[model samples]
Target: MTSEKLDRRKKYTRMVLKDSLLKLLKQKTFSSITVKEICELADINRSTFYAHYQDPFQLLETIEDEIIADMRKYLHTYNLQEKEDALRMTEKLIQYFSAKHEELQILLNKSGELSFERKVRHVAEQFMMNKMTSEEKNTHLPEYVSKFIISGSIEVLKIGYLRDVRNHQKKWRS
Candidate 1:
């Protein structure tokens, strides 16, 4: 295949793999999913799956990367110089999570693994780090603070979801 054709084929394969994983994630936890399942859902061969990803977890990482990339792209287009901007971004993120409650409940709450939380926290921290000014980065906040904030927020959200408190806008506001 020509270079362009090969690139196109690779893109198509990744798309297939992503679609397959998303479909499966709707049905089962990431931990329960297998290479055979992915290949079967993707309608691709084992070798092709292996050629792209070592496992489903690796594919999940790619999906997380793409998600963060899109988030960063939006952040880049904005003026992150104000505290309100950051707060709004966080609110937007919460709304995004609210929209994906079903998918997240399956992948995060049901999966019996902390990988989803870790990925979410990682992305949140990276987003904050990218937005911070050099002076802010230097003082007042330690590097671990971002992790703390992300994890704490996630824990709060998880609790809210578990208690069916997510539906109460007033409770969430408090």
Candidate 2:
């Protein structure tokens, strides 16, 4: 029971810290963010922050790692060879993006780091390569093709999301 309680407390501390960092990312780039600011925003002590992360950059990297891991899990759930499965996977991916919209927006747009975006593309590319049919793998073209498609799709999602956010803001202000 004591161990469980400690686990819960640790989870809560990490949650608040993640939230605080993301909230700060909205106002400034990750490079400009400080450990002190994150702790103050989280209402957590700087020592506690250091206990969990080396710095704000590490915390951000942790967040990115979690996102990529989740994406990998999602990608692995479907056999992408079948048309129906592929369609279902795409739908699920969009749903995942919708669920993570705010966090993604901050990371993809606000963080001012291409690293996260590149990591996302790399994960997707790896998933595609692993799922490709033997025949498809024989041709080197699929590798390049998959990279192009994944990168374009991610860019389109980013642009479309930003446009939707702007439209929503306009509606809210009117």
Candidate 3:
């Protein structure tokens, strides 16, 4: 096969594996999920899984890494100094979260993993810190304040997103 075809095959294999793992996470904790189960769900061989990832945990880590990278990209895309730009940046982030709701809900709430959530909070905190003026940083208060704000913002985002999803489902049912 050509290199392009080979790369496409590899990408498809990884996508299915990641999707299978996320689906399984919705049903049970990550620790209870097995490589065999992932392969079975993915309809790919165990060898294929190992070719991409060592185990389920590594697969989960890969998913989390991708999410963090995307979040960082969104954060760095805007100049946060202007209030209008800050609001637009927030809207972009919200749109991203909404688009990835299922995957994020599974990772953040159902995966029984704290590390992924912490990584998200860290990313937000770092972005906030980076946007702060030098004088603000010199106060030593901005660090603590930013941490508090970022932590609260993340918790609100998670809770609010879940609530919004549940509300939508209810409306659809009715």
Candidate 4:
């Protein structure tokens, strides 16, 4: 096959594997998922699965890393200093999750391996730390303020996106 066709085929195969893993994650924890199961669900052999990823955790990490990278690009591409920046960021998040709703919902469902949720929390914390006033070193106002607002905003986005996905699924079912 041509190089273009081969690359397309590889991409398609990776999507299938990731989708299969996501589907499995919805039913059970990441730790419970096996390479065999993923391969079976993906309709590929163990070797094929191994070729792309060493194990389930590796696959999950790969997917989460890609998602987190995309998220950072989306959220940090513009500075969030004003109220409208928050609004724009929220809308962008909604759009991002909506486009990959099902896949995101599953991978983000409390993966037992690595906590992307905690990663997001750390990111928010770092952003808050950067925004802290240098003169108010003793106040710690940034920590307090960001803990309440940014963390809450992240939670709201997660809950809202998941709820919207569930509602969409329901709409499709009925």
User: Which 10 consecutive positions of candidate 2 have the poorest summed lDDT?
Assistant: 83-92
On lDDT, the stronger of 3 and 4 is 3
Judge candidate 3 against the unseen true structure and give its global Cα lDDT, from 0 to 1.
Answer: 0.74
TM-score of each: 0.59, 0.76, 0.76, 0.67
Question: Clashing pairs in model 2?
Answer: none
Per-residue accuracy of model 1 over 1-174 as CA lDDT, tens digit each: 245446888998899998888888877777788999888988899899999888888998787666656555554554355654456656555555566555454455544667666766666666666667788788857466666656666666665473354467557687
Candidate 3, 45-91: lDDT as tens digits:
89999898988888888999999888888777764545333334444
Model 3 TM-score? 0.76
- Model 2 lDDT, full chain set: 0.75
Candidates sorted on TM-score, descending? 3, 2, 4, 1
Regions more than 4 Å wrong, model 4: 1-6, 80-105, 111-114, 126-139, 154-174
Clashes of 3: 0
For 8-117, candidate 4 gives per-residue lDDT tens digits of 76897899998898888878887788899999999988898888888888888888887777766666654465433333444444555566565555655564533887
lDDT (CA) per prediction:
0.68, 0.75, 0.74, 0.66
